[model samples]
Target: MSQSFAIAVVGATGTVGETLVQLLEEREFPVSDLHLLAGRDSQGHSLPFRGKNLRVRAIEDFDFSQVRLVFFAAEASITLEYAPRARAAGCSLIDLSGALPLEQAPRVVPEANADVLDTLSTPYQLASPSAAATALAVVLAPLRSLLTLRRVNVTACLAVSAQGHEGVTELARQTTELLNMRPLEPRFFDRQIAFNLLAQVGVPDDSGHAHSEIRLAAETRQVLGDSGLKVSATCIQAPVFFGDSLSVSLELESVVDLVAVREALEGATGVELVDAGDYPTVVGDAVGQDAVYVGRLRSGLTDDAELNLWIASDNARKGSALNAVQLGELLIKHYL
Candidate 1:
């Protein structure tokens, strides 16, 4: 890789896309030229890059010839359409959708899987795991490194922004109308999301597990490199605007002390340990932060080997955009 590289940011106007741009600047990734690509509806709009405004271009019309890397934050369908072309154009693609399975494409978490990303071919590519999965992975990394993880049970409280801008607007509108004592109308979500929580994100399968829950469970095991680990998850949509919170319980191989556990988490990268006594973390505080804030650490009274903790992160940033950008940096350092 040269001192500076040409980069393309697909879906350049969405929440995650906006964060990607900010992170690329904050981290000082070498970028000589930046191309912003979005859908037809978003063309003609401009977003600030570095200091000047960069106009959004229609994805169909943007040329990938000079692009050395592509950071995709668009829908899975859009990724499916353009990822291969960008790769064939000799550009490394870092996807942020679950459109492709891990077997076909590398499933990456930069802090946990940087070694896997070290080697890449001309068309090498990968997608980030889900927000819920990413949060759990951060919590599980230190534990997996020290002890054998047997099983994990997680319940995720996700924000409306996870559904995109429409979900956020719908929640706000519903809140205002309810305060005025008017009838509520549902749109982006299956049920009312304001002043309430839904235990479902995607449709439930015959096994009674919602798709988001299933993905969290499966993806956690994969990212932790523990296929034999048993995982059960429940995903809920909260009224919050940003951040993802997870209450996690782990069953380990042997007994572990709380002091040892705290040390492990505190020493881990991309994670911060907040002592429950003085500084408690919330969705608002977790937003715009790169590290996952973990607090409320406790031990299972019934089983000494088991541990529980509360973890939170900005789902759109640390969970998605920052993770993608981190992978981009890794690619630049190792393969670019």
Candidate 2:
């Protein structure tokens, strides 16, 4: 007997949103009735799932009570407006947008924090950690258990696609225009992100931290359950179409050998250890992959009690949509 249920995918037009739909089908999520919802402009759109086309509807007209689960792939503002309404109508909200009220909703990374399942009294749950934060959190999970933590410093080279489909298209368009010797029009991004790297992922605040930096720091700490975890973040938007990479350094309370570190990483779920000769890169390795491919493991040069790592993963998959779907599986097993 196949157990099936009604599911709604809000924001089906977005990249992460569409990825979630694919993952849901790929994972065989027992989706008996699938509802695709998007904005007014996308109302007539149709997306393929399991070889059939599902018509898209305006989300403003969606009836949440009819669905058992609502996966919100919409913008934070849209989620804010409707998540509560969906919950009020008796549906579990899989908050892929990372916009849920943090204190009220448990931010779940199943590989790192499955304990959230034991305390699942709330209707809201987070399906995302900032890609930088997700990469950092999964890597840190094994280390946090082995050593007393001190501080973590990371620089994330987020792909241009992190901003959405427009970001990807803009990079392509600009590259073509530059090759044709035309003047670049910086529209989607604040700066020329065609062939160059922007040191900050968003406009800086008074504290000199970009929006990505702040989100990475705060979300990393929250996901790790370490309020005092000293996280210093530097985020840059790299000119790649997909995959996100991170350079991470950690100062621990004690020394850990590289061999043991490798063993721990290999044992961790949603993580994979790269061999010494092969370094993990965005294009060569991580795009379309589910594992957080990690390499460049070495003893910290300056400090004996520290370690360094280079990590990469598909920002759209393991970082966001896949994590959400994995959490949804947990939600079904424990609560639903």
Give each model a TM-score.
0.95, 0.96
Predicted structure 2: lDDT:
0.85
State the lDDT of candidate 1 residue by residue for 1-336, as single tens digits.
Answer: 458999999999888898889898998889999999998999898889889999999999777888999998988899889987887788888888777676756767876766666555656687788888987787778766677777898889998988888878989989999999999888788878889999888789998998788778878877887778899799999998888888888887788678878899889998888975644355546888988888888878889888888888889988999988888887787776
lDDT of 2 at 259: 83
Candidate 1 error regions (>4 Å): 276-279
* Global local distance difference test of model 1: 0.84
Per-model RMSD to reference:
1.7, 1.5
**Candidate 2, RMSD to the unseen true structure:** 1.5
Error of 1 at 190 (Å): 1.7
Which lDDT tens digits does candidate 2 get at residues 89-170? 8888787776776675666777788786786665645556777788788888887768777888899999988888999999
Error in Å for residue 329 of model 2: 0.7
Cα lDDT of all candidates, in order?
A: 0.84, 0.85
